[model samples]
Target: MADGSDPEYVAYVHGRAAALRRTAYLLCGDTHQADDLVQETITKLYARWPRIGRVDNLDAYVHSILVRAFLDEKRRGWWKVRLGVPPERPAPPHPGVEERAMLRAALTRVPPRQQAVLVLRFLCDQPVADVARALGCSEGTVKSQTAHGLAALRRILGNPLEIGMAR
Candidate 1:
């Protein structure tokens, strides 16, 4: 209802919120934290709607915002505060849940920047150039991060042969 309130911006947020939340969840491995990241990113987008609307790839721009938000959250010391252990819940009775859990656990062990690179490149299916632009790094840095991320994942997962390093 303010000056920045525009139909296109509303539509863009409506359309992309779920995807952004999913990406955030992958980065943080916690649904509540992911929601916070998405909310922060959306708040930023609303404040910069005029400028962001003119970008060639709005999705990429928003992704860059989301990734940066996650990184910034990591840099803050408050993120390390945990009051108590969460209640354990049974895993979903679905196929591939174990594999998904394994991958996610390994992902959590990776450094925040490398985790962002892996999530953007593999999970979001972003190209090296786009990822570099999003992370404000060079293409070569992205590539190196991807390699290191994968290697760390492999080491955590404990199967160098099983995990195929493709793309």
Candidate 2:
């Protein structure tokens, strides 16, 4: 058995780890980077477990930590370093997979703050108020970011129809 194991903390981590990983993956679009983000977030959570335990919304607190960590990583110059060239590969054959790939590629083109806003609003189904609180911005900012991010995505994708925008 692990020394000084806190059952509550262990259970919380177990239940939320997958969700955290998925959010991280959407933010970074790389499984390895997502894993790193989750690991870092969990470590920070563990260190502040006592304070975090007292929070009314644990999920939101953890998400805030995760998002901030991702933003911080992006701000660091070392995070942009690529070690090797990529090999060429054929496109996905399935339409669904291809569409998802295209969407993700377009998402990567968005600024980090806009990407975070879009992910939190659409992917996580968070309300504008919640997103504002998480990003430490006003609700108006979240709404504007969502609009700008969608516009940027449409431009990058070059097919607004494909994004299913309402007329």
Candidate 3:
């Protein structure tokens, strides 16, 4: 740190960059945009790195930065431009890929706060308390957002259980 850069920050970012990028992708559903989010998060983290030692959970702190960056971008609405149709990615050969793709698409339609809650609690398998801490909200709020988010997803995707019950 005395030499002008914190080695811990460098190592931390190097180790977690890919995971953060993946989380960003989940938040935005665009690879290029996800990269931008990660870059924004890393830049913010570097600025605050000197105080990292006092933090309780470093990963959660960094994740909070990434999510906030994503939410900020969504609020600005500058990335809505269509530079022509997006290129189609070759579908993965997994059996549930279609379902996952559908879910991802629906997720983008959900409100940002709810989407963040769902991604953190279910996708990342973080505890309710951890998610609350990362989002800077109460656990009750996280739980409520998650329920609303899931309901939105179910409505968007058409609940399979309801369909089966009707049959």
lDDT of 1 at 158: 88
Clashing pairs in 1: none
The C-alpha RMSD in Å for every predicted model, in order, reads 4.6, 4.6, 4.9
Worst 10 residues of 2 by lDDT: 79-88
TM-score of each: 0.75, 0.80, 0.76
Residue-level lDDT tens digits of model 2 in 30-118: 89999999999999988887665467778888888999898788764432333264522358786667667667766766787888899
- Where is model 2 more than 4 Å wrong at Cα? 1-5, 76-89, 163-167
lDDT of 1: 0.80
**Where does candidate 3 have its weakest 10-residue lDDT segment?**
76-85
Q: lDDT for every model?
A: 0.80, 0.80, 0.78
Q: Pick the candidate with the highest TM-score.
A: 2
What digit string (tens of lDDT, one per residue) describes model 3 on residues 1-167? 22225787788889999999888887777899999999999999888877777777788888889988877777635324323657345676874676566667667777788888888787778899988987889999999999998898788778663421326
Residue 11 alpha-carbon offset, candidate 1, angstroms: 2.3
Which pairs of residues collide in model 3?
none
